[model samples]
Target: MANPTGSSLLVIERLLRDRDGIWRQIIEERDLKQLTVQMLTSSALSLALYGAVLGASNGPLQAVSSFVKLPLLFLATLAICLPTLYLFNLVFGAKLSVLQALTLIMVTITVTAVLTLAFAPISLFFLITAQSYPFFKLLNVAILVLTALVGLRFLTAGMTALNDHQLKVASRPPALPPAVELPADKPAAAKENGAVLTAPAPVKRLSDIGGRPGELPPGERPASMTLLYIWILLFGFVGTQLAWTLRPFFGSPDKPFQLFRSIGGTFYADILQTIGRLIGG
Candidate 1:
C-alpha cells in the first residue's frame, strides 16, 4: 500500500515544482479525488498557519479564530464560485467535468495558500515591530492580494494548456487509406496529349502549420477561457466581500478581541478608511 504521508508530500511538491504535470492530470481526469483531497489538506494547513500570524497581532484567542477563519474564507469562496465556473465552461462547449473543474480551482487555492504561508514570517516581523494596526492590516491585505494574483495566473495558464490540448485533438486529421501499388508499366504521372500531368501539392492543415510553441492560433481560443477570465474578476470581488463579512481576522489592537465584528462598510471603503487613519496617524 502507498504511504498516505508520502503521497500528500508528493502532491505538495508537484504543486510547487511540477504544475504542468498537475495540469496534465486535471486535463486527463486522473486521480482527481486524490488530488482534491491532497490540495485541500495542504492549502488548509498553509492558510491556517498564515491566519495564525495575522491573528497574532491581537492575541491568542484571535489567533485561534483566524486559524479557523482563514481556511474557511478560501474554501467558502471556492464553494460559492465553483458552480459558476463549471457551468460557464459547460455553456461554452468545454468538456471539463466537475471533478476537473474542482481540481483546477484547488490548484489556484493551494498556490495562493502556500504563497501566503511563505509571507507569514514577514507578516510576523511586522506584527512584532510595527505597532500600528492599520498599517499591519494593509500589509497583510497586500500580501494576500499579491499571492492570489500569482495563483490566478497559474489558473489561467492551466486553462490555456487545456485549450491547446483540446485544439490539437480536435484538429487531428483523419487517417488515410493505404496506397495501392501501381504497375511498373504504368506511367507515374498521367498523360494528356503526350504531356505529363502531376498532382498538385497536398494542402497543409492548420494544425500542421506551426508557430511559436504554446501559442494558440488566431481566433482559436474558446469562449470558455474568456469567460473564465471574467469569472476570475468576479472571484476577486466575491472573496474580498467575503473577507469583509468574516471580519476580525486581524483584530484591532485598541478593541477587545471578538470572533466577529459588525459588518457596515464595504471592503474597499474600509481599506480607504484604514489608509486615511494610517496616514493621519
Candidate 2:
C-alpha cells in the first residue's frame, strides 16, 4: 500500500484539481482563430441584413443614405446577435461554427419572438419617455437588459470561442476513463468513484499565467445561470413601467418643439447631448 501521508496528500491534490487545472485547459482548447473569423463575419452579415430590412421597410434611400446609416445598421445587427447567443448557449452547451451558430440563433429568436416582444415595447417606451421627460431619467431595467444583451454578445463571443475548443477535445477519441473507478489504495466503493487526475491543478501563479492572485476561475458558467440572468434583466426593465410617475428634470414649454421638426435644432440637440455625454463619460 502507498504511504499513508503520501496518499492523504494525493487526495487533497485531487480534490482541488479541476477548479484549478482542468478548467483552464478547457478554455484554452477552443478554436480561437476560427472564432475571430466567425465574430467579424457574423457581425458583418447581421449588419447587412438589418440595413436591407430597414431600407426595404422604411423606403428607398438617397445615395448618401447608406453612408449615414452605416453605424445604425451595425447596431441593429448587434441587437439580433444578443438574444440569439443567449438562447443558443442555453439550448446547447457546446459551441458551433460562426455562420452555423449565428443562423441557428437567429432562427431560434425568430421562432420564440421573445426578443421582438421584449424590445419593441421597451423601445417605444424609450422614445416616448425621452420625449416626455428628457432629463434626470432613471436607467430602468429594460434598458439595462438591452444594455446587458449588447454587452453579453461581446462576452459570449469570447465564451463561445473558448467552449468550442474544449468541446472539440471532448469529442475526440476517449483519452480518459469514465469516473467509475477508484485507485487501489481506497476502499472498493471509493475506488469505484474513478479517481483519475488528468493533470495537476494548473500552477496559477505569477510564473504561471502572469496574472495577479485571487482572480475568479475563468469562463465557469452553466446554461441555466445564463437563462436566470436574462429573466432577471427582463423583469427589471418591465418593472419600470409599473411605477405610476416618472420625475422629469427638463420641463420645457418652448412651444413643444418636436425633436424632428427643425434640422438645425435636432443637430444642435444631438451635439449638446454628445458633449454632455463626453463630460459625463
Candidate 3:
C-alpha cells in the first residue's frame, strides 16, 4: 500500500488519473487520513490563490478574508450535508462505510479547491484589467461554478464506478464447501426431547428486498434518482449559504474592510443586483 501521508501530490495524481484505484484503496485500506491531508493542503493553497487575486482589489485585510472564506465554505458545507448524505445512502442501499463516505466527500472538496487554484491566474488578470466590483465578483462566481461542476463530475463518476464494482462482486457465485455434521450426542438428546431451537433470523438489508445484492427493485430506481437530486441540491444550498455567511471576498468599492456583511439578501439576489448596478452605472 502507498503511504498516503508521505506525499499528497501522489494522492492528487491518482485522484486525477486513476480515481477508481484511489476509491478501491480507500475502501480496502479503510484509511481517510490521506484524504483529510489532501483536503487541507488543497484548501490552503486555494485560499492563497484566491487571496492573491482579491488583494489586487481589496487590499491586505480583504485578501485575508479571502483566505478565510473558502475554507469556511468547504468545511461548513460538509458539516451541514454529511448527516443527510449518510442517512440517504443508508436508506438507498449504497453500502458505503463511514470512512468511504468521508473520503468521497473529501475528494470532492479537494478537487474543487485544486480547480479553483487553477483559475487563480485568470482571476488575477481580470482583477488587474477590470476595476468594476461587479465584474470581479461575477467573474469569480462563474469560475467557482465551473470548478464546482467539474468537481461534481468526479463525485458522480466515483459513485457509478463503486456501484458497478459492487454489482460485479455480487454477481459472482459463492463457493460451496463440504458441510460438517453436528456431533451425534447433542442431536440424539434433542431428538429424544422433541425440541429444537430455531436458528437466528438473518438481518435484512435494503438491497435484499426482492432483489439480489447490488440490484435494486424497479421502484427503487426512481427513489435513488430522487436522492441524488436532493443530494446535489443540499450541496449547492449549503455552499451558497456558507459563502453568504462568509461574505466580502470581492470587497465593495464603497465600503471599508470588514470580515462580513450583514446577512439580508439571497445570494442569487445579490448577484443580480451586482450585475444590474455594473451595467446601469
State which candidate has the highest TM-score: 1
lDDT string for model 3 (93-125, tens) is 667766676777777877887778888888888
Whole-model lDDT per candidate: 0.84, 0.36, 0.72
Clashing pairs in 2: 21-202, 29-165, 30-165, 141-237, 142-237, 181-191, 181-194, 182-191
Query: What is every candidate's alpha-carbon RMSD to the true fold?
Result: 5.9, 18.9, 6.0
Clashing pairs in 1: none
List the candidates' TM-scores in order: 0.83, 0.25, 0.80
How would you encode candidate 1's per-residue C-alpha lDDT over 1-281 as one tens digit per residue? 87432365456677777778777888788778988998899899999999999999889999999999999999999999999998887676677788988888898998899889999999999888988799999999999999999999988988888887877765666465455444567665666678665544455555566734343455454537679889999998999999999998999877799998888889999899999999999
- Rank by lDDT (best first): 1, 3, 2
Give the distance in Å from residue 256's predicted Cα in candidate 1 to where it truly belongs: 1.3
- Which structure is stronger by lDDT: 1 or 3? 1
Worst 10 residues of 1 by lDDT: 211-220
What TM-score would you give candidate 2 relative to the actual structure?
0.25
* Candidate 3 C-alpha error for residue 61, in Å: 0.7
Using lDDT as the yardstick, the better of models 1 and 2 is: 1
